[model samples]
Target: MQTTSTYKILVVDDDPDIVEMLHYNLTREGYHVAQAGNGKTAIEEAQAFKPDIILLDVMMPVLDGIAACRQLRDISEFRHTHIIFLTARSEEFSEVAAFEAGADDFLTKPIKPRALLSRLAAFKRRDAQQDEISNVIEIAGLRIDRTSFAVYKGDSKITLPKKEFELLSFLAATPNKVFSREELLHNIWGSDVYVIARTVDVHIRKVREKIGEENIRTIKGVGYKFNTD
Candidate 1:
């Protein structure tokens, strides 16, 4: 139901030029925009701006993007917020670290404005689709609540990053039905977003860590299933 005009975006980068470019482009697209010069400031700005989407830079003074992302994810209010990392580092480890820190997406700069815009549009479509799905699923002792974007294992609360939570929720929704990694990638990340199949495995592992490994069963070479038995 939220329109482009109402959707807030926070662009955080140490480089003034990058921040300026992103601000101009996002504002031109009718998105309400805010900017921060570093990760530390980004967190403070996020508290006040309350952006639906955040474009964060990796290398920064005061605090790094990965640390900032981890800190942000710990905050209950921002748990479901979209965080995309924009970094010059294209190394595989950097990408893995970014995801581990709870980033929703990773982009290497020099940023292509058009591609970034397309990704943002894809996120908007995904959000709309998410709104149409069932909001909660309870299985065994686990409860996945999409309404608050929170999960509960019996009376104990478990906090999972956005992608991990989605992966768990999607599988748990279908009980014992097994879903391939490709199917999970398409369903959770969407077909428009380019991410390797391994990303699913990473998220699956993280989800298991929070909710317990026994809840999700890996079917040899086939894929993963939520164990209802």
Candidate 2:
């Protein structure tokens, strides 16, 4: 339901050239774009602009992107916002740190505008689909309330992390339809998040523990499926 004019994006980077580049491309693509010079400024702008998506740089003065992302995640208003960290750093630790800080995705420097636009388009599609399916989902003795962001199994309400809840809800939305790990990652985290395949397995195990393993079936070499039968 995000029209081009209504979709707001905040581009945060210390480099003016990069910021200008993103602003130009995003505007040309019919999105509302704003720019910030550093992480601190990005945080301030995010508060005022309430952008739907944020493209934040990893390194900056006043405050670093990871810390800024963490701060934003702590706030209820920005908790579900799409935040993608932009970094020149290629180290695995840096990527891990970004995710731990609550970034939805990460992007390497020297960005290709066309590719970025494609990813954004894909995200919009998924976001719209999720919106349509946000009503309470009940399947296999599980009750998922998207509005309350809560899940229940039988009579007991389960406490689940944000990602786990999303994963479970998505699987239960279409019971018995096997979804590959890669597909889950793409749909849940967006196409740009660079998480390893093991990440999905870890989350799956955690979800299974909370919801009971019998509900979610592993397809060995293939993927996973929710059993409604």
Candidate 3:
């Protein structure tokens, strides 16, 4: 429902060229843009700017993007914010590390301006669609509230990163029905986001750690399902 001009974007990278390029491109698209030269500054700017999207570089001085992202994910105010990792490293381990640190999307630089914009547009479309879905789901003594992006297990509240929470909620909504990793990837992250299948396993493991292993079941080769019985 909101226009591009209403969206706030934070571009965090150590390179001045990268920051300037991203700022120019994003601003040209009518998005409100801010820049940070390192991870520490990025965090400070994020607190004040409250950007809806962050393009964070993996390698930076002071704090690194992975650490910065983990810290940001801990803040309740940024629970739903989209954090995309940008790195020149295309190694599998780097990709895995980014996802584990709470990154929603990973892009290897030599950044493609058009692809980046498309990813942001996809996120906007997904958000609009999510707005129409039911806000809360209660199952097996756990409460998943989409409106507040909160999850409660009985009287205690559990903190889960964005992707973990979405994976949990999606499975819980259709209790006892099995869903493959590919299916879940398409539904939760959307077809526009590029992430490996192992990313699903990482999120599932994290969710189970917080909410208990009994709630979600692995159906051997079939994928995963929420246990209702």
Candidate 4:
């Protein structure tokens, strides 16, 4: 199928080769590209570039992607930006860790450009649909009532599923902090059942989409935490 490139993507990592490789492939595909070699720079570039999507690395110096995701989440201007983690680690906990960091999705190393593009395509569709959803969490807009099985973005009502609301409430209970998938599993889903941590990622993506609010920050290699500030 023929497609037009309308998305601006930000690629952040400490590895120059990865940056170069992605930049070349993405640009060749007709999407605009931006790069940063470290976490702080990733935040800076994201702010300046105003990309439609971000491909963030898990490990970096002077503010790993997880921390920067926390900060980027605070800025209202970049609220709608979609974030996906680009990591070299692919263990049971690895994916869960990225989700805890607020990542929308994850991709392992030995870069597969085709797979990357396809994933971005799905993200684009999901991202477009997210614009109309209202995921307003609140504490009078300060406290997201992940409790009461509800979310109020300063008095506005944002509906969510039972599971989604539970997860949000748990994460929001502690804003701007990280939570590993294991912790979330035990807390949100309970530890007694058998499940993959990636289930958290599925729920997180759903939560973000439904809220229509973009404040959850993904910390690449870690887990997720809510950010209200």
lDDT of each: 0.88, 0.82, 0.90, 0.71
TM-score of 3: 0.95
Q: List candidate 1 segments past 4 Å from native.
A: 89-93
**Shift in Å, residue 108, candidate 1:** 1.7
Q: Alpha carbon lDDT of residue 103, candidate 2? A: 70
The Cα error of candidate 1 at residue 33, in Å, is 0.6
- lDDT, candidate 2, 1-229, per-residue tens: 7876789999999998998899999999899988898788888999999998999888889998999998888777886788888888563445556666777677777988987887677667766876776599888788999866688888898876566778888898889999999999887876655676766777788789888989999999999999876
Order by lDDT, highest first: 3, 1, 2, 4
Q: TM-score for every candidate vs. truth?
A: 0.93, 0.77, 0.95, 0.59
TM-score of 1: 0.93
Error of 2 at 26 (Å): 1.1
**True-structure RMSD, every candidate:** 1.7, 3.6, 1.5, 10.6
Please estimate how well model 2 matches the true structure, expressed as its whole-model Cα lDDT: 0.82
Model 3 residue 29 CA deviation (Å) reads 0.7
Native RMSD of candidate 3 (Å): 1.5
Worst 10 residues of 1 by lDDT: 89-98
Instruction: Name model 3 segments beyond 4 Å from true.
Output: 89-93
User: What clash count does candidate 1 reach?
Assistant: 0
Can you list the residue pairs that collide in candidate 2? none
